[model samples]
Target: MSRTTALDPLFTAVDTAAFTDRHLANLAAGTLAAVRVPDFLGNAACRAALSALDRLPTTDYDPGRVPTPIVRFGPALNDYRDQDGHLDAERYWRDAEAARVAWHRAALRPDPIAVSMGHLSAAWGAALAPATINGRAVFGGTLREINAGALIHYDDINREYPTGLFDQEVIAQLAFNVWVAVPPTGGATTVWRHRWEPADDHHRQAYGYRSETVEHCQHVTLTPKLGDGLLFNPANFHAVEPNPDGRRIAFAFFLGLTTTGQLITWS
Candidate 1:
């Protein structure tokens, strides 16, 4: 894709019954802001996943790194990154294995991750593969309870691991989230039309940026509903609003579109 001098409109959100190839393609190409599927997971399945949450081991992110009090289950590679931007392979793999065991033990009927991946694969007309490094598959999907909310941030694997972390090269990346539980009010996710710029560094705060970083950018906000699935490009600065009424939880992962037209996944 060549850079055109066109002033494209800021991206907007769409509600769809299914994840379609057009949705995936538009997201990667920056032509769409987000695609949302209401009730992507059946109500019974969502309840089952929520129930299984009790048996799974959940942890909080390091307070020093992430001031927000977000609770999480499953392993995310970003959490195991070293100061030098390299992965702490030993500890990451250890937790990865433990998480796998715990997930199986939870035995969530109609595994949320599996079902989400299946729908995505069907939409793309290709099987989704796990992102690998050194020929080892990386962990995919994480369950997060974000009642207190997340700070404004963006995610780009290329920038995070400049030398490369995955064996597969990614041209573009998108974030996927499926809500199993939601609060009565608040907990809306807002995605700005902004991507990180060098000058934005001045507004840095912990693992994210200050709201001022995107104050001037056009954006869209989506209030999550139980069993709703949302897909969007995380290269845009985004944040989650705090929900004080009830627990707001979701299963999340990243999808990267490779140069070979293949889709790969990871948490």
Candidate 2:
């Protein structure tokens, strides 16, 4: 008798309704909400990309200093700083350049996508016209860029948990995260949480930002399989699980968008 192998979940078609109820409930409870785009990349392309990514190098560094700091983007236009406050464009540029170099070296991929000068220019224009945040004038710009050869996670030997949140808070401005999964023995990225509870002792004693308010956090597993991709809200708690098989490779792209208003284009 011939044995039949069970198919991997990665190759199965995920039910879109799987998390619909959970997503809506979270949004209503003021925790967080998310949407997913299945089959984000075609099967063949996803496989090819993952195969390429496997060959890249993975370097370690302090996540704090990476991608530049939020403060460097300049005070929120609504911040208490004076109109003529000292703005250090040079410093910001230097930091950005350093980040780019470090990112490229770690991934061993040349020509990663970046926030173009056009993006900066658009930001400057937006800054000139004060926008409101928390009922105060604010200057804010969002930019999205790609990291072709990016290591999504690293197994931290020093920590009790094998995983690390290498890309947290640092890239908050990028509201969306996209990962393309390639196949044939690729491991999935895992996202984790402490099983969020609103009534825990830890939740009750918190001040400023409270984890209690956070409904739940999740760990994502990006398994290598043709036509697999994930998109999620980054402000929420999340992490990527290490690819165990070493066959999984991915290209992650960060996306940003304005916080206010709707677009209307007439033809």
Candidate that scores best on TM-score:
1
Tell me each candidate's RMSD, in Å, in order.
3.5, 14.2
User: Tens digits of per-residue lDDT for model 2 on 1-267?
Assistant: 433344322221132422333442232232443344455455554444444443333343224433311112112111222234432434544544454454444442222122221222243343112222234322222111122222222111112111321112121122222234332343444333322233433543211123333334333344434433343443333333333333333344333222232110000
Worst-scoring 10-residue span by lDDT in model 1 = 1-10
Best by lDDT: 1
Poorly placed runs, candidate 2 (over 4 Å): 1-33, 47-224, 262-267
Clashes per model (N, Cα, C within 3 A): 0, 19
lDDT agreement with native, every candidate: 0.93, 0.31
Instruction: Put down candidate 1 lDDT per residue, 1-267, tens digits, no spaces.
Output: 333233347488999999999999999999899999999998999999998898989999889988989999988888877989999999999999999899888888889999999999999999999999999998998999998889999999999988899999999999999999999999999998889989999999999999878776778899999999999999999999998889999999999999999999999
**Deviation in angstroms for 19 in model 2?**
14
